[model samples]
Target: MNKTAVITGATSGFGLAAARRFAAAGWNLVLTGRREERLAQIKDELAQTSVLTLVLDVCDTEAVQAAFSGLAAPFNQVDVLINNAGLALGTEPAQACDLAQWHTMIDTNIKGLTTVTHALLPKLIETGRGASIINIGSIAANWPYPGGNVYCGTKAFVEQFSLSLRCDLAGTGVRVSCLAPGLSESEFTLVRTGGDQEAYDNLYKGAHAIQPDDIADTLLWLARLPAHLNINTLEIMPVSQSWSPFAVKRDQ
Candidate 1:
């Protein structure tokens, strides 16, 4: 039987790329996103694969539960879940950042991810042995930087949550992995910059950052790995990206 993979935030970026990648691999797809039109387009594009599009906002807890509960037949038998619905809003210092943006990040990245995982755990356990949960974490989770604030905190929570989940689901044969990526070229930067095309262009001008397709390829590999092998955490960064020198403030 062809395996089924459910990817959240399937409208764009990593989620969208992963949807295409999995579809090409002949996996049945349950792709969820806030954009109904885009989801429909994706479904149509991957017509050869069994596709079910759920117009959903992962931040909506009630909707998350409803979406999973309402799944029928093959789509309901989830072999892999790609928790890719997340974002980083505004690049401002902690005190300068808007409280609402902070809350939104926490809601989507932490609450939303956990909500989806909780709803899908039973099906994953039932599928057993080869089941997988790939949480799209970030380098921000491990290395703090200015203007990261709550977005960083939320990702850190994802890493820890993934680890704890593995411990809790130990005997269930459900594998949890956190995939943290650094410096990628996607609409993610556009969202963070609030659609400043110049800023987006400048940031990635010469940086051969990790692409969505690259991440998608990684996800495919993870899903195809042997049932007994589990990768707890995998961090990938482009050669063009690396650690910066620690900043020190001089006394004036």
Candidate 2:
């Protein structure tokens, strides 16, 4: 029997790429994005596969609950849930940052993810063995840097929550995994930088940053793994990316 995968933030980046990857593999896709036009375009481009597009902002709790609860037919029998609808706002340090931006990150990255996961648990449990919840986290959750304040915190929650959730689903056949990627080149940087083209360009100029397709491929691998196997957490970073020495400061 063919499987179904639900991908959020499917308008662009990793979510869109994963939708295409799974579609190419003959999986039914339920794609949710805040942008109606982009969702329409994706629905058209991936016409070869079964596609259901929902204009959804995961931050809206009622909308998320309603959308998932309302899935029909094969789409309702979801095998994989890709929680990719997340973003980082300003790069300003905590004290200088807008409190609103902090809340927005918390809303989308943390609250939004959990709401959808909660809404879909019943469906995933119904699907039983081989069911998977692949949460898109960030290396920021593990490694802290300047200006990463709230974004880091939210992703840390994603990582920890994925672990805790795995414990809760122990008896069930549902698998929970968190993917933490580092230095990816996508609209994510543009969104985080407030559409600053220069900043986006400079950040990835020669970094050989990880691509959305890479993450999508990884998701496919995880999804296609044997039913008896479960990968709890996977961290991916491009060869060009690595750790930096601890910052040191001395009084002048």
Candidate 3:
């Protein structure tokens, strides 16, 4: 029997990379993103694989519950759940922050993730073979940057919640793991910098940022581990990029 995996934020970034990797591995994929057109494009591109696309915003609690609840029978028992849909609105210090951006980050990165995980936990627990929840966190939680206050806080929640969930799901044949990445080369910087190409480019001027595929590869490894073995947490970064922002060389 083929395994099934559900991924959020499937339209781009690490989520898109993981979806492609999983499909290539012959896993049935249920992908959700806010953009229906992008989701449809991915679905069409991966037509050779069994794929389902749901265009729903994770921040919409009601929509999230309904969409997951309505999964087709075959897709209902998710073998793996990847909560990869999140964003960092702006690199603003807390005192000078845009409250709207802060709230957006909190809602999507923290509340949205928790909502989806809660909705899928029952299905995962019921899967006799066991299931895994891979939450995408950020290394910013550990090494705070100058203007990453809200984004860092949200990721800190991800780290904490993953640990708490692992404990809560103990003895239930469900595993919770967090993948915290540092300085990844993806749409992340573009989105976070609000399309300021120069600013985004400057962030990685001299850094070897990890690619989406790199993170996807890590997810695949975590998923393929022996069912008896659980990888509780993984912190991934490019060899040239240390965990601390203090080591990052910002272009003047």
Model 2, CA-based lDDT: 0.95
RMSD (CA, Å), candidate 2 to true, equals 0.6
Off by over 4 Å in 1: none
TM-score preference between candidates 1 and 3, better one: 1
Give candidates' CA RMSD values in order.
0.6, 0.6, 3.2
Q: How much is 16 displaced in model 2, in angstroms? A: 0.7
Q: Which lDDT values do the candidates have, in the order given?
A: 0.95, 0.95, 0.89
Give the alpha carbon lDDT tens digit for every residue of 1-252 in model 3. 889999999999999999999999999999999998899899999987899999889999999999998888669879999999999987777888899999899999999999999888888998835589999998887878789898999999999999999898888878889999988988988898899999988878888889899988899888888787787778877788764325656799
Give TM per candidate. 0.99, 0.99, 0.95
How far does residue 172 in candidate 2 sit from its true spot (Å)? 0.5
For model 1, what is the error of residue 241's alpha carbon versus the real structure, in angstroms, after optimal superposition? 0.6
Model 2 C-alpha lDDT per residue in residues 32-124, reported as the tens digit of each score: 999999999999999998899999999899999999988998788999999999999999889999999999999999999999999999999
Residue 167, candidate 1: C-alpha displacement in angstroms: 0.3
* Structure candidate 2, residue pairs in collision: none
Question: What is the lDDT, from 0 to 100, of the residue 101 in candidate 3?
Answer: 93
Mind sharing the TM-score for model 2? 0.99
lDDT score for residue 120 of model 2 = 97
